[model samples]
Target: MDEVARAFLLPSALIWCLAGWFAASRRGLSSSPVFAGCWLLALAGNLSLILAAELLVFYFGFALMTFAAYGLVVHQGSPQALNAGRWYLFMMFLGELCLFTAVALLAVAAGAATALGLASYHGLTLGLFAVGFAIKLGLVGVHTWLPRAHPVAPVPASAVLSGVMIKTGILGWWRVSEPHGPLLSDWGPWLMFLGIVTVFYGIASGLNSREPKTVLAWSSVSQMGLAALLAGLALTSPGAGHLAWLGIAWLVLHHGLAKAALFLGAGLFQDSQGKARGWIGLLLCLPALALAGAPFTSGWFAKAALDAAVIEAGQGAWLPWLLTAGAVGTTLLMARFLHSLWVTPEADGLPTRGPWLPWGFSIVCVLALPWTAWVPEHVRDMANGPLALLSALWPVVLGLALYMALFTRPATAIRWPWRPRAFGPRAAIPALLPGLVHVERRMHRWSVVGTLFMFVIALLLAALSLRISGPVA
Candidate 1:
């Protein structure tokens, strides 16, 4: 690795180490060993990427990170957790397979042994990379795993998974786009269309979900869709690449901090106070509002930058409309989450306040930092303008309106289902016995072999297809 790469390695490695240590020290020996191992593996894999001088090493690093995350998801030992973890692993492995095929094709076309650095790939290779990375980014159909996994993992794990891990796909795409910059324009519209679909799909499903964590998971899906839209705009107009990069970076920072806070808070509320704490419920609204791009929040700056960039690219007309609709949908989801919390019965006694420093720091970071760093100078003058403020306000208003219209009556009438219904215990049995046992006994033994076979089949098909069609005309 070069000096620049080494510089990047140091910070990432240190952060990984700190995260692992923090997680380990929090609960000590009582902590889940499987979870600790997963964190360790992810740290090692991400650090290895910095040292990876070739494609094979990079591929290995990526795979290690992914598999480790999957383990973390299932670490809770619940049936729900395990099912989610299985889905997460299956999707990740599939994404990796697609990526490997694309990398191999790039190597063949370039007549090079290593297409590791990404600057080596050309037009068709870039397209493949885009699709592969999009899968990881949770674009449309490939996004099914995200909603399942994020809600089931331990809180801290969920925070990092949503905050940092998914952005690796965005980082990968950024790296791949470096060389064939202008050529990517051809793929721009398709990416935009896919991104728009993902954004709305997430919002729609999130609104339908009853669980707070599940709604948050779907929110991540929607936020990622916005990121993809910015990336698509960047691809369409190479001159706007810097803006796109900034927007993406802003997204990573904004969503990471905000979602982490929300997930961690959710976990704390559920564990200690039993989700009935009124104040805690109200506090939850902050992150959700920030996520919806409410006025003066970090999300506002991020959304503004993205909106402006798309407009400047002359893709303005429909893209803005789509984004506005997405914002409305997000608002509705947040309102639903808040209403759920409000109606749920409080625990019998007053809740004890835990250490405030950690929670306060996380919330402040989510609320403040992204705007300070990412709001560009060009847009500075427009930051507090009427249009910008109005753009931010309307969504919250629409969300509130929808919430009152649809959920208010039901929320008021319904009582909390505090105790699990009798059928719930029985429901748990079938999910546990067959699925977990099958995975442990027969399935675990054969997974590696089966995965290898599937990988081979996928590669063969890609090769056969390539031979038949010389290249894109």
Candidate 2:
């Protein structure tokens, strides 16, 4: 690796070390072995990436990171967590398989001259990379694992999972694909469709969730949908590359800081005794607003930049409306999250104050940083205008109105069958199995072996099919 590349990896490695030390010193080596192992594994994976000079190395690093994350998700040692972890692992492995298959195809097609760097391939390679990365990005139908996993993880872990880990997929997508066309050409519309579906589904599922954390998980799903839209725009228009990068960078920075703060605040609120403070409520709202692209916030900058990119690409016709709908959906989801907060049972016993510095600093960053640095002046000026302010405000208002009508109504008056009956042990077994339970269970103990076997089987099938078809005369 080059000196610059090694330097880039230094910070990640340091953070990994810090996390390991913290786990060991604070929790002890004996306690939560799984958690410690996962953390270490993630660290190792991340470090491997830094050291890696080839695509194979990168894939290996990513694998380590993902599996370790899976361990962390299930480390809390609950039945719910276990189930969630299984789902998480399954999705992650599926993504890995897709990525591997894509890489293999690229290598095969490109032959001996293929470069190991992400930028080496185009066309079919790009398609495979997109599918592989989209799985991790939690795009639409492939997103089922996210809602289940995020809510089940510990608060800190949830923060990292939602805020940081998912963004890696975005980074990967950016690295692998080159942008060189008009926006909305080729992959743009498809991504827009995926983004729209993800946005709506996330909001709907979030609204359906009774748990506060669960609602937040769905919110992450919704927010990433917007990120996907921005990414698609970048892909479609090479001219908008800088803007796209800026949008992604801002999204990553603001969303990570803000979401982490909110998740921590939720944990604090859940753990606190007596009445939750007015300040906690206010602090929580800040991140939610930022997420909804409120004026003067990082999200607004990202949204504006993304909009500009689409417009510059001459693909502005549908995106504005799509974005507006996405905003409204996000607002509704945030409203549901807030309502869940209000109704959540207060913890028993005296509340102990946790260290508030991290969350406080994060919230401050979300509110202040964008105004000073991230966004362009024109966009910022527009965000301050009446029309933009109204656009942002109306969604919150509509969400509030909907919440009052549907969620705040008396339980007796609502008559809905959405809530499933609590499962007994017998019922839970069937619930756990779903459709592929038996197959999954049989494969579970032999997961690595089974996975390898499946890969071989798939490759052989492809080869057989190719041979049968012969040369395309």
Candidate 3:
């Protein structure tokens, strides 16, 4: 495998292993074979796709990973979990259809071995890929399922779902788009615009939520937005391509490791008592700070690289400022997460074997990232300068101040899209975007609508095939 595949594959495996251990510790290994089997199968799909040398192998792996994860999402077997599963399944089906159509068109064009011919169908293929990747990345309109799924799943399952699985969307984009240079020129700006919307939408959505996992899920959406932004930069300029992918890689690692830790730590807080809760909060802060881009942390390292990419791409007039603004939103999102954890009612104090060792290992891995040889020397140095440190620190300070002002006021002062219910099976406040959720529900009213959507796609595919095969009658 090449360096990029190797880079993504290793961390994905590491996080899955750690997360599985935590799941077992929390859920008990012997209790259910279903979770274990689905988990391992998903791992295989995630890793194999990364290692796949060909496009079709990658597509099969993506399908495997997507369907297998439904088991994880609905493991709790609650009504809520079942509901979330429906949303997840519906979205995946649509995403897969989009991808299949795109890949098929790509293959037909590539078989001709002519860039000029490939360019002819570039717009259609690019649009299909965008919709497909957007569903997986959980961009704003497609994002309702994420908060729904996260709160209902077991903590470890949630970790891999949020941390590892969403990233496959980014990986899929990289694998599909990297080969065909034809679409990038026209398509790049739109991707960046989608990224910006996702960034702010995620922050706004998460900020309003009171559930810890829901808040973190929103944070994942926002981070994915940043990934999209970096992706846009790469697509915008050939010169910035290498560094932009590098920045995306850094983001994948930083966010995956930190967010997983946050999820695991959230689990630990549930069973924790007074003293243990205090300690758990202490450990959770490391990842929390990283997500907020605290200096010298992996988040800072990744963000700095992105900044360099913006400058390198000569989009310095606006993109960097938007990113800096994103940093402030991220800081507040992190603060909300921590606040949710603190406010969660304590669980049964009867403690069994906890997930301390694995969770601690994850934390160590997170903190150690900046010093790792994998990081560039200059990116590492970005954490050290006096001005650089302030640039990182100020957003965090401002976010905290805003959090105190907004949330600390009287409870009745605010009306969020959803409010926190008591922590339990029904704890998650359902549906962040009620309007979109309504649309999603109406679409699901009958299976025929889904089939009709498929039929439409099938017609599109046939048209593309004919376009490639011959002139229309």
Candidate 4:
């Protein structure tokens, strides 16, 4: 409907369609009509949310997408898939509840917000929106469901979940809230700092991970954090406007296509052999390299565009270094993922239509993306000159150099400053998280889950009606 909608909708549609094609080509659970229907339903919800001009429409579409994806996550009926679905559904409902409540408050505050500015209406309403969207984005504290869900779900489902679905959080935030305003003076710095923490946390956790899917999931968390940095900068910087949002949108496009390709490639890596195997692995590098901001890649152009926005935001002194660190971290994560693909055991059989068609197309799209007209004309020329080229190239080079010196051989590996064990709270979650086991148990019950589901829908509808019709006398 608007440029903002187009920016968000284009990537969502592209990734979902590609992932859908890849999903349909698979065997087993993915081959079922039920799976296809669920996939379509989820896609509808996703696209609807992006196109939504009304708050109620947005909330309903979000709920539809969230609930429908549970079917995809559990389609295989594996113990792991079932468990992951439970967590996914639980966290999703919690976020939905918060978002629904936030919407009602926003509607009620519409008059006051116009006078005082929306964000200043009430900190609770905005905070609720932030927490709700943050969960969707897979930020640090609320990210437990993401790593679990990605590895257990079918590959195509994982692709869309990470590449497309997670980004709705940013879009939702943009729709209803401003990153900076009188009431949220502290929010910009806070989100920016949290974004940094999330980046390092993802890198450390992903580096320690051997499972390629889990690493990819962690990388999603990191990328979302990078997007947050841009959003926060836009909030704090007076000069920021369309440029900042455009940068974030381009980021969503770049990461969506690249991450989708990576997940799809990961799916096929197990089933591949002979020339097919070689091609899949080789082509996987394009998206991975793009993610690393390697020269001539979409990552290169996207990062360059983001750099321009950061400079425009007047954070030129430190933001470039921060982005460089993220680029280096992404390169390491991709290296870990590529290594796992080689070491992973082969699948018992190939998919029905073979692996190359959808996945190869995805790779081609990722590689050719920058040449497309989706990018702003100004950003198209951001990488001009040798200095700009070097900036893009060095992060990738440093990452590969570190990988060669460290992870490649045991003798060259460094353990001096610290031992190379699993370095994050990921391993210690059960011990660290309060009553997690009990909560997981409660979530497993059908009666409890159904009740919760009904409750959320009813509450959302009630809030919407009460706000729209006014309070009873």
lDDT of all predictions: 0.67, 0.65, 0.79, 0.78
Off by over 4 Å in 2: 1-33, 43-53, 105-124, 179-185, 275-277, 350-353, 376-378, 381-384, 410-473
lDDT of 1 by residue, 1-473 (tens): 76424434533443343334335444432267777778878867766765676666776887888888887788777999988877787778777876787767655765766754444544444555665677678876667678889878766677767776776677677666644557668777777778888887777666656677777887888888887888777878888766776677667767777777777666556534654355666777788788888888877876777776766677658777778888888888777666654554544566544434455557777666645634567555545699889988898899788666455654444443432222221232233233432332342234653664475466547554754233432
Go through the candidates in order and give the C-alpha RMSD of each one to the true structure: 7.5, 6.9, 5.0, 5.9
- Residue-wise lDDT of candidate 4 within 1-473, one digit each (tens)? 87778888888888888888777667775659888888888999999889887777888889889889999899889998998898898889779888878776766656432211223335555666787898899887677778889998999999999999999998987776553443354677888887877776677667767789998998999999988877776667646746777888999999999999999998887776666667778888889999999988999888888888887778757777878988998998898889777778766665334656788788888989988888787786788789889989999999888666556655233453332343332333333344454553454566665674565566555544543332111
TM-score of each: 0.80, 0.78, 0.87, 0.85
Residue-by-residue lDDT tens digits, candidate 3, 54-165? 6667778888999999999898889989998988887888888887776677667567332211233455565676777778888866666687899998899999998899
Local lDDT at 238 for model 1: 83
Q: Against the true structure, whose TM-score is highest?
A: 3
Of the candidates numbered 1 and 4, which has the greater lDDT value?
4
By lDDT, the best candidate is 3
Overall local distance difference test of candidate 1: 0.67
What TM-score would you give candidate 1 relative to the actual structure?
0.80
- Residue 87's lDDT within candidate 4 is 84
Which residue window of length 10 is worst by lDDT in model 3? Answer: 421-430
Error of 2 at 155 (Å): 0.6
Compared with the true structure, the alpha-carbon lDDT of candidate 3 equals: 0.79
Let me know the TM-score candidate 4 reaches against the reference structure: 0.85
Which lDDT value does model 4 have at 442?
59
Q: What is the lDDT of residue 303 in candidate 3?
A: 81
Model 2 per-residue lDDT tens digits across residues 245-341? 5566667666776777677778767766554555687778988888877766676766766666666667756777777777777777777777778
